[model samples]
Target chain A: MYTTMSSSTTTTTSPSKPQFRNKLVSSLNDIFVFVGGAILALLLLWSFCSFVSPNSTITFNISSPTRPKPTKLVEPTNSETTPPMNCAQNELAHDPPDHTFYDDPTLTYTIDQKPIKNWDQKRQHWLAHHPSLAQPDRILLITGSQPGPCKSPVGDHLLLRFFKNKVDYCRIHGHDIFYNNALLHPKMTTFWAKLPAVRSAMVAHPEAEWIWWVDSDAAFTDMDFKLPLSRYANHNLIVHGWPNMVYEERSWVSLNAGVFLIRNSQWAMEFIHAWAGMGPQTPNYSQWSKTQKATLPDKLYPEADDQSGLIYLLLEENQKWADKIYLEHEFYFEGYWKEIVGSLRNVSDKYLEMERRSTAGGRG
Target chain B: MYTTMSSSTTTTTSPSKPQFRNKLVSSLNDIFVFVGGAILALLLLWSFCSFVSPNSTITFNISSPTRPKPTKLVEPTNSETTPPMNCAQNELAHDPPDHTFYDDPTLTYTIDQKPIKNWDQKRQHWLAHHPSLAQPDRILLITGSQPGPCKSPVGDHLLLRFFKNKVDYCRIHGHDIFYNNALLHPKMTTFWAKLPAVRSAMVAHPEAEWIWWVDSDAAFTDMDFKLPLSRYANHNLIVHGWPNMVYEERSWVSLNAGVFLIRNSQWAMEFIHAWAGMGPQTPNYSQWSKTQKATLPDKLYPEADDQSGLIYLLLEENQKWADKIYLEHEFYFEGYWKEIVGSLRNVSDKYLEMERRSTAGGRG
Candidate 1:
């Protein structure tokens, strides 16, 4: 289960564009991405927007005629009778007289419905009303495993550690973590499960700015590491990969899809839909798989996977998606496990040394 | 592992105090609690205080000598440097220009430290500053398992489902859930592990009034069921058991300590220390185990356990803790698994039938 968690291949092309090589570009013959940890690719993310301009947005007008603002704060007379405990969950457990996106009647949280539009505007409008959630960056980490007990005797045990690692990281960082066991979409099994989960999370957590998706097998080796959110100010999706492998060699293993950071913007919603289109749940799954294999002759697998699907989007539709997709290699976002396990001692030592120096310098 | 999760046995002694019999009461001979789900006891919880008297409090006076009130709200200068994602985490992500418990420099969050005094006032003081968190009742659901992979290959898998079940329940109810894997106290293992975790949670979540601890093996069979907080308004700790078994029969399996709801109060702090005093981590482990066996002649086990420890507190120290500890047996609160599993279909049918009638009656 841990081995198959990733679906994206390595793509190391962020600045230098990989020349379009139609027939299995022979330039990527040496780069061999394995199945184990290769699938747990990191997708670095922030909404694809100008961070310098918060006012610049594509969204519904704030002045919606249908959503008239309530004149008084709404308090729960009896919370248990109305949706159990969820009611007016702002800072004071009360909703102000001012209206937010929740007052809108047309919004839907289901993934199968028509994709959400003007989400950035809706979230901003809601945040404006709540204000308590308006601090710069707030993230919700979403992860899950298969619905049932693992087929492998120790599979569930491995998944348990994987989950614990995440919980520990979140606890120390104060980030909210969601662990899912049910299949959101019945047909979207295996690698494709994350899409529906992410989509649902956006609607479920309007308070969150980013919805981070990490694979069940992708443990946070560095508990203290924090994401560099500032660098991905302009990009909407971030993944670790070698762009040359994806574009020049047309290799399916150019980028990984195991882990990625995604903003709760309309762009992310649309991107998820487009990426999930090549999954088994879709009618065009066979055609997409055939296209992927034909496009990247180096691809050994027969069925269209999420990693190949992402690579396809980056290669065939480079003008459309590549600019927004970040191929991060400056640091190990989600490095190979074998290499990382051995080097952890050295990494721990370095971090400790740094801490010692900082303490000595009175920075602690 | 599932069977061992429970430390307390059944006790039916909320109103009718069990008559004490020095030797084996002989009355509990027929009561044999098999381990499996007996350990999944539910501790129904609420702070032990007069629900009608909101202003009544026994705590440190609002006026403290050393801690001075701030004149302005504090915002995060740089969240990454201090503590990754935790800063001013009230409704507005800002602290008002008023003193709360956080202003007190002498307060400690660790369990080994001196017990917190006048916590009610401190919590009330903090609530006064952040009115948003001062709702009538707010609960934090806390659960966890062993740090490493499970000895039973399926134990971790079972634990995962148990956790996911909780997540689902919390998601629907809009409650915060925390899953701890690390041992809060290295010496505190098994049932005793919950002590340090619960103690730490009280400090971590000052916003939460109740800290609910449910064993990992205890799954939430009924997703829609909500705790009757009003029912436990005047109690600080709740569990399921019969009083006769504990006092009269002197049986070890009287009240279940598996699942319980404990309030965040000075009383709870003192109570936890008393309960944990009998664990292996304490110096009295051997003596307590020996005394427990002598006191409860029916106890088959020879080791000091949390369930027996809780019973001991209720038995010997009845005047000190019994009033605060509620014995709940009204419904299926962490009931036996085999019984619940077989009856689920019938239970579902009853709920559906009621729903059908309600819908017909226009309640839908």
Candidate 2:
């Protein structure tokens, strides 16, 4: 319309002889009628073609009250197609129609119990059904304290800040977090409680690749830092450890089980089964403690701890599990608050200086 | 193939004279050939029809490694048609292509400042683009504590449990949560801090209808009970109140301001502006305190509190904001820990008894 109006204006603005202009006007009117009819015919043909072609029929619409947006229906199980708009309003509420491992009535999500088999295949099936949440390095932080109130009056307060810190870190990193105070197994007390919680979380959040167990006592001092998941691509479990220190000190609690990233896999499940065998729930608990104590005697504490059990596993079954277990020695995962608090200022100043340099360079 | 095999088996089983059977078989073969030719032609026609009809071609497939699950490309912004599979692995990473209020140069998410107009329309557009998160009653629990450690030795630990309790409730209810200790606006201290935090949450989560402010000091005693959001459909803001108590006792803190449910609407934005206008940041802060003290003559304390200011607002601006503000007298939003704790065991026991009755009834 704009082009036609501009063309008409151009013809009118240009100077012309009166008789010639009159003749030209009549000719132009006849041509206009003919062109208009032709254009109308072309539009009709285009409309007919569009009616037959479903893909080509979706025209650009903005605030057109006459039409709701174009939509396509999707079967719940088929990740092959997503719901056009509201299909996955229940996105997190997705349970693919085609049965995965959940269909097997025999399958249990319990810890230190029956082991899960063919998890990789089952996980693939799950991923195929829920591609929206199938990122390989997605983490789910699991942390919790005892069910009862803190013995120390100020204990609960400290816990709140620590939990808050974890929540902050998880939110910033787009990771899911679970804080449970329930004791899943009565016998699996203290550190052994992690097993049932981790197992349950694994079954609950198939979308997450790693069930990150950040101990309730620990805190995320540097909120800006994110877990470098890609660095442990080959490994399924990662824990902060100094093996040389373990050898030198000959201490039971060498590796800080306080914070660790364990992959949601069949191997991890098996490792958990082996590790939890040392807990009070098992028949060999006393024997395992004796074995561990004989290896590395400690004067202050004597009961077989979860951390100590893991150390025993690494030392005893080095050939079997060490290949998939990553000892994160380069960075400290957890430390004393007094030790970590002082360096925070330096870290903050360094970050600020880097920011200034980047800003200056950008201005230039 | 199964059908054909069954037909051959039937032919073999049926008794007949050898010579007559042979002639019958030849005759049957001729008839079969003619019918088969017709079927083959029909199959060809059907395949051609399926090729044209896009929707008809998706056949049931199980464990077919030969074909990667069916997939289609998606233009991210167009919720009209979602990507077939991997298109929304970045579902949480959604940013529709259309320009929203966020695109406006002068817009700010800061509290008690520039007001957002046409928020209903803006939220509508956002919901349209993100139908997946467009639940009308979806909640975003906003709670926090002081940035510094609690002065009491066990203060931090108590805060952690309260936060965890909130987390547990939010998780079970399928609601998102945000915990921020950062002072967004410098002068908004103590109770005044909620306004900034609420405003920030409203901007951050356009998906949620209600920015539920549950104070860090409060915890959900009833885990089974969900906020009956449908009950507050007509109201934009809901806070627990005892109007009769306020009238009779004439205390400064008549109603508990520890917990409230405020809807994410333009009305809320305006309410925040009006409410924060009486904060420490404003020149009338002292005057407002004096006004509140005059209204609620309390002997214990005289300083203006957020709860007292709220009471003053209710008394002074009864006609203006009262209609949208629901004073929930039917149930308590918050209460003292000691007051709430005594009834918890009875509540749990009743629930257990009800469950037992239901199970027995089901078996019968």
Candidate 3:
């Protein structure tokens, strides 16, 4: 009786076990489907959010404003059949009539048809093809001025002759010259005129590599003197400086602005503009006065002027500006008017003596 | 016979006078022709020289480099028969696949076919067509950091939290934040770090109109305060200052750089670049030291930090920078760290009390 009861119980339990197993499998399948579907939905949502993110939206909006219309849309054909349009060709067709053409059509045809060529023509072709082989051109512009109101003590004709002599000297040395009778502004006289004159020359002669300003009072003592461009290739401005004055006196006039050379680049332009702001016309004029009083006690002149302004920049403002400025001590730039006159007389007497000697030798 | 001889002599004399007059006239004509030809030749030569002058040569050479090949030269056809190729249409046809189109073909067709008027759509179209109608967008960037190796007594996490809190406050007021942990360099820990961080932030986020750098030690006391962009529209940089400090002290630390705002314009970029050159790593570092020692005797710190650099710029550099910088003394930026800690507890207690009161009222 016990064996029969156990077998019946086993049979019922076996059926229940199979049913429970099937239910568990179905539940697992449902869970897997639900989780996969939920994940897919979340992924779609995340992608949509990313698509509309602020940065993406801004980019899209900006691009949309500039997007072209759809009317002229043309699908790109096979590259082999329809080669890309040459940009050079298109540009040539649309170019203005003012364009200068250097290419010789006959030469091109000859090169394609024949292998033989003259050495000269080959050299010419090479030169034409490689135009950038030449060194960068350097232009030196020498500028100066005589104040309109104050006639030079040496007389107007003598001053004019002096400037003309300078001009002739610059011309012989392959440098250009521009001499003005009036200041940039009537108010800017004496030392204040230097900044504007330099800036104006820079604007007027953009092709010039360097703009040099020499004061009317200054005379070229060394006719053989040539500003070696190679030496100043790395420098922006070159000014005469006495190291002794710089170290000991720390005088505003240590670096003379009576004669200076400035590179005609954007940096120099900006520097000149900054320097000009310290002039009497600017709002910082009072500040310049105070700075002069504080730093440069020897500057007796009430007007701060460009010299004091530059000294302020070198000593106090920014050392970067100071770095770009080359202090040249190799040449004497300044002499008193009286001393210069006496020297001029001695030079003329020497020239006269040389002329007389040459004539006597020719006569003999 | 005497009468015949007299007549013969008279005839000879008459012919000789005529011959002499003819010769003189011919010679004069020859001279006129020679002078005229010489003048014409000189004029032509001058014109040729002018054409080949340095300025003209430079212009020609510069233009020649960019001149396209003459292969696809096409004469513009009559406008009536062959319509002009629109630039926009050509651009659309050749546009890459990455381009996004915003033009709705249907909307354009509808607008053309049916002149139905909708004011809102019209206004939107006008707004879309005229984009310059919108006000210039302004973005504020707040940044700061403590260098590595200088572990704050207040934990790094706490300092980060403090910065994060400020960032949250700025976000609520419609601003962004960028916090750096490491110094730009190990040597840039003290004052040199400020310039590099500001400059890097400016470059990283070009979208920001203004970048405000608050020092690590500073905290935002006023949570609700919003920067008045309109007020600072004309200024490039804004700093905290006392009028008396600027005038009397003239000290490098007179104008605290704890909090400052800088514009993201080209001028500001250049200014920052110039400012960074005064850093200890730069060649001008020693010069900066000398300037500080000479100018600001009261500055006890040996390091020529950004603050001293800026003060040097304001007092001694170009005044244009001073004009752009606005000094504010309305609010406090830095207090003693201990005082700030004490104030934080008071603020927390006030907030807690408010929360308790609100919860009690809700329960009642």
Candidate 4:
């Protein structure tokens, strides 16, 4: 009676169900268990392998036998010493043995004994190892300014062209050039502007070995004239000076600072800072003034500027500065702005000739 | 005979040597001896005082009388425990008492027991204390691009103007903007470009708390609509989506990723890295192609772009990503490029009105 009722219900509700479907469902359960077990086993093995030797699993199977074995544990030695009882004891035990009392007659410090107190010796030692001091790596910072207060014969565009020409010249010599229209420091003016400009350029171009300041009015008449580094072997500054003005007359305007080369060393940086301090910005600037007749009797010229300040430092402060300063009379650094403009046509041929020679050498 | 010779030499060198000079020299010598003895005694006293009470050199006399008499030496305590014998023993003794093997089961690890395995909970805990998540300090980085390959109806300059208009809209709503002309990553295209652009903007503007990328093709039709931070209080990303496309259709083109806001967060940076990995530059990118029907049957679209990759990640990857993502349908995020351009005339009046209101408010 139950079988007849089940058949009647199936007929009324659904007709697709068969005894084969029930058999298939029973078989699927075994397959599901096998697949699930496989996945679980794999996951466990992966986790275990990862925990045992992290990062080794990727190339574990393929690595050759010659590969270095894992570091072996070292056995404790009988000769090993005992550690200190406390942190203070450990510090005292580990303190460097080289540092002894200065008054100890038995021990002597070679560095202290050496006469390194001299500024020239210290500067030479520092410059010898400076990373950027390589011959080719030297940087020539060619700065020119057409500030608002300063009047120029040429237009702004022409002034830019003149600076660009200087840039081209430096580039050909394998040196970096930084040119800006405005003065680097606000307080700096006229010849004094060059000091801050060179200082800032040194700061900006850390890789540069030297800083060369060419005034806005100054033109490169001798494009072929390559600055021989040998000439500045022991010098930090290179400027033009007339013997009559520098030695005999002892004039404030003895040295022309319009076009000069300054080594981009710490000494030059310090010197530039000192020179800038003596400008109109400082309290001691009145002492540097030509009008201060009682104080600066020799600097009676109206145009006593940063040049005069540099001269005062060289003459009064230290002989070491005088020794490092190269008073070059070999080259004509600059002439009057009018004279430079007039000679540009004549110098253009020399510039072209130098460019041709450089190009030809590069090609060869 | 020696005394007579010295006297004869002195008389020959100085004929007018007076007796008063000898008396003056003797008196000066006596005064020097007295002053030197006093100075040496004072120095000895000062040194002894310094040794007895170190750190009392400054304000030695001004300190309060009640200030504890410079600490007196104390005898060693008999109750003190013995120190470890060696480094190994010291290490064992110093090991934190709480850390023990898990199998011992006596101690419990709170971290292991907590549900930190759940990424969403972990992320929430991390983001809660993050400084950039502060509400008022939030910086919105708005970026758009006019890439080289993409052609626009208006000139590139006008496209820039359109982006600038969006910048103005965001600025009025109190947000920063970063505009760029090209894709940050060379290999990225279409929506893929947005990833690198957003990443770079995050790096460039560190002060920005969020980055909102608006496509060059998109425009701000509702300039008055301001996005309140509260809307995305718990969300890391905010994009527009339709319910039908997001759920039922599960279409790759469901959400508009063109104009979306991403929080400037560590989580966002990681997400961007993952997103960029799916671009054409990566080795796994070939798996995204629809032509490989056997592997990627679901991604059958010819243009399987960045949007498609994002949709794939959402559907197949973690649900935590979806929880953090806010899919808003409140307002339209993007329209067809042509439609946006066409509606510019209508939106100009609203923009002008908002500008006037802002100006009046600013003035008041």
Candidate 5:
């Protein structure tokens, strides 16, 4: 059976506009004479008065007793418990916070009569505000031809679970292809070379103070990691883990895609745009993976992964544009299976405690 | 001046169906008595009569004086100079002889009363049979932010140089962000992902076979690639590329995302559905910069990226579902810049020669 998605169209009819005809006009000289004499003087005077007068308005909203508010009045039904299926409490079960959030006047939220499970109103709003939201400036992500069993829970599931909710995210599942037989990690950096996700967002949302990129499984000790919408009130790239917190540098220490934010500053957008264009042989990452292995400092490691490739990109191109890169310590943290789980659990515990405390207060 | 992009909000008006009068029909027996005793008996008798009597007619088409014969219609206004820009053209633009085979018909094809600049009606027909042509399934090539760099000769120049007569190939400068990036990719893989042009054709004429996705730069070399439409028939993903070509034993082979054919095949759609899924925390890739060193690869890659991720997933999980993934090597060659550009250039030269020869023949 075909399922119906949301509808966004309506048809309305309106009465035709009234037509008027003017009497025959004089010739060009006569027309000028008509305007140049008393009529022109009166027009000029009227224009000056309209410009100077505070009361002057192009149009007026004339309200009358007969004109009613457009709001649809809700009639009290005879049945107390019964409601339309769309308005049923069952659907609200998924969104109980609506009851709480609605009470918070600060949020200034309007509840949709029908909470569509499929359509994202927030995304819709963002899209409408920035028509470009639907089409991305650039889509940057990692891809592999043959991914291994991936001893690391790093590819799809882990990636999706962590970040899918924070923002608009899509996980493309390419066939199990690897640059180097699942040995080398997904060096999305090379692919990002072509995709311009970062630069695009800045251009698309000028009002957005900052644009952050976070990997799915990256751990956040506190939900405070949510970049304050006002953080870089003025635009600038607020990358963490990068050295000196500058636009360029090999220290690449800035927050990993694991968590990096752009202040939507001119410097950041220009930097990203320049970067997408300048590259060699388009960086045949597939071939490179086959030959090179990852080595941390003194030891050479087999199977360079997503992390290693990132390090390589940051380091190999360090001298050319190192100064622009900035490293943030707050964003730099070790990534591991246990650590991620621990962080998630810690966040969960805090949430539970908050809930418990709130409930107790309510009871008191 | 702002030029509107080629996209329409398909407002699906779900005709509100009256809720059935179920209060009286709660009992199955009562429902059967009401339906079976009257309508069912009459239908049964009618069926028996049709089955028993050879003269009893069932199949019928409305015949009226007002009905215009299909052949009696006037030739399209552009018929002499251009081909129909109908949905069928969109579908045919993606199909076989047009994209894969040696017999080139597109060179002669015209559209909207104008000879297609670089492409022919043959290509249009190819797209008609392949619904996926205009619908970019995996890889999205977005230009700089804003719908038209109507000003930026950068991307436009590149596309024009590559796809000749193909003007609407790249969605445009930053229009990519207008449609939800993740949603569009998923739709491409799922039921909704066909070229809008092709969809229009299907609406105009439903009997077309497939949809083809061939960029202006793409060209047939050996014409050895057998169109996959023959095997899968409807909604099939057909292409020619080196498959099972392992990159260091990872079973890696790159295919041309620009020139792949898709028929309305269940397998093709399932592959797309299987490929599309949104994950949380996909980086706001809109800001990724070439200068930026790779950060976390696994973390940043979002779902619905260029089909590479999906390809990786398919291969990784092949043992679990091998039957669904078919390798259509005959129809698509890897259009990687390094490997195919030379051959493509050679083909372009040949095309020029062919064009000259045709002109000479026409003159003779």
Candidate 6:
């Protein structure tokens, strides 16, 4: 997501004296508090704009909502090629279909890919696969549960609309079912509290290939999420969020977990286990409030959570995976709400038109 | 988790030409690659030493084998003095007796209190009425499915042994489980390949709390693990292993997710939902080969899984639950593991003695 907001104003404070170091530490805390407050202010402003002047424009160029459609739907050339194995088939014939596979199951999913043209297909595909999620792929969508003004039927509507029509089977108690009782539970901030729900959701839907999460406020924007969906379905992680193209500073990149994906594969599961497991090296609460100023402007600066704990974890993963885990650019759009919403609404309208055409044309 | 070595060696480079500033806008990708690596390297090394090093030591003056005993059972004398009813009890008591809150069903019930303790006899007494945890808490430990020399079982055993008798209950699942089942798919690094199995395990056990993790080689030697267990059962996070008090330079402390914790609470569930529903923020693949330059460090400096992800997520949670979320201190003697494996056998033996004594003493 691109934006033209000014970076955090950095005014160098000349060192007063050797004794001022202690004073500086105290002052740094104040500064961070101020920064935090400023961030809150910025967020408040953004929220107001999002609510009141939701169509505000900002300077940034996201990808155009242009994409190519599949030339044709080829019949199953051979049983080996299209014989349904575990319901993992291309999206062409399945009554609803898997939204994750794009049009083709073999597409190397990327965030930048633009194959999905409409929300109906996307929602339908997800609904079909929601019930058919692989046993290991059942997911627990932990909601903030604040019951704030923003949370609306749209939240539940999105899930139901997306999952009902598309999904044919789900890993509910190891049984394939189109739908099951929607499980609702209170949200927990602690890893321990969430583990059981996550585990059970995964266990019940072992057939689910990926555990999907959607924030209450987020609405689908069409370009094609299948590419990113497939790609995210492959990463093993407890968490992965969007990283903004704009840099507040070197160490930090803007991040949003609002729309991130996680792989339900064994490694990813263990990564979650490892994260939520015992014997973690806890941060020092007493001294964490203190801060030391960075020396260079180019130093990497993490944004809040990005700074608090991610840096350490990412450092370790870097050692292991090197260049594997990351945030997507195209999938997460923050600024220029007017443009994004415009894109989203335009794509949605196009999708509805295409749906009507397909229905009238029969299953051809 | 303390280390005396500092790997930040000075590197001499030619003075930058003035044009470098002109290219700053364009070179952000390059500059970040370098800066992110160095900072992450420092943080990772520090985190590893603080949490990963079983033999690492901190400078705290706590007794070696005299770990604090679990808080004495708080027996409320007067039932009439009980606090008013609220949902906090249900929220806090999200886990059941099966996994984390391992207790007789008759004993595990909700109570009214400001700050709930894990084993408050008064609360337990009150819990008899609210036998309503049809939804049990469970933990799913996740790890990137990197095929490294780091043996999975070694890591699994480390975790199993640490929380063996301390936690209420737990189970271990590895990447091989998902791979053998043919669900071995990953999107980010090969390390992400392991998530499927963990998710599967979680699906199987919907009624469990706190998935604990430990790196293959990490060790745990302590006076007693009662505090650690209760804390994990309480906060529900990817807790760190241990910290090195003597280490001054390193500030960002985290235990390897190889040994962390997660909650089954609402916040955690929401996080999982968001991850699965939305395609995750993808990493910058353009910097895939940037691992060559020592100065540039790896583009994936902070790997975005397990520890880092948890840290990131929980830090965000901390904003909501600041006082409630906690990270423990690094003790000097029992920090990680030194050469005290067999030496601590007596400690475990003594723990057994204490357990027997407490049981024999019988809720006095």
Quick one: best DockQ, which candidate?
A: 1
Question: DockQ for model 4?
Answer: 0.01
Lowest lDDT sum, 10 consecutive residues, model 2 chain A, at: A41-50
Per-residue lDDT tens digits of candidate 6, residues B169-224?
A: 11101100011111222332222222333333332222334434333223222211
Docking class of 3: incorrect
lDDT of 2 by residue, A125-173 (tens): 8778867667657677887756555544444544564566566556444
lDDT of 2 by residue, B32-133 (tens): 110100010000000000011112122111111111111111112333222232221223324455566655657766775667888878888877876666
Worst ten-residue run, lDDT, model 4 chain A?
A: A41-50
Docking class of 5: incorrect
DockQ, in order, for the candidates? 0.11, 0.05, 0.01, 0.01, 0.01, 0.01
| Model 6 spans > 4 angstroms off | A1-207, A221-234, A238-253, A273-308, A315-317, A321-324, A332-339, A352-364, B1-364
Report the poorest 10 consecutive residues by lDDT, candidate 2 chain B: B41-50
Give the Cα error of residue B284 in candidate 3, in Å: 78
Compose the digit string of candidate 6's lDDT tens values, residues A170-284: 1111111221111122221221222323333333333344444333223322211122233344455423333332222323233333333344344444444433322122243
- Which portions of model 4 miss their true places by more than 4 Å? A1-137, A146-154, A181-183, A290-304, A337-364, B1-364
Total backbone clashes of candidate 5, pairs 3 or more residues apart or in separate chains = 140
Task: Please report, as a residue range, the 10-residue window in candidate 4 chain B with the lowest summed lDDT.
Answer: B40-49
What is the fraction of true interface contacts found in candidate 5? 0.00
lDDT, residue B358, model 4: 41
Better of 1 and 3 by DockQ: 1
Candidates 3 and 5 compared: the better one by lDDT is 3
- On lDDT, the stronger of 2 and 5 is 2
Model 5 — TM-score against the truth?
A: 0.25
Interface RMSD of each: 14.3, 23.4, 37.5, 39.5, 34.7, 29.6
Predicted structure 2: lDDT: 0.54
lDDT of each: 0.58, 0.54, 0.41, 0.40, 0.26, 0.26
Q: Residue by residue across B51-132, what tens digits does model 1's lDDT show?
A: 1111212211111111222211123334432333324233422446565676566866556676788888888888787665
Residue A204 miss distance in model 5 (angstroms): 4.1
Residue A128's lDDT in candidate 4: 44
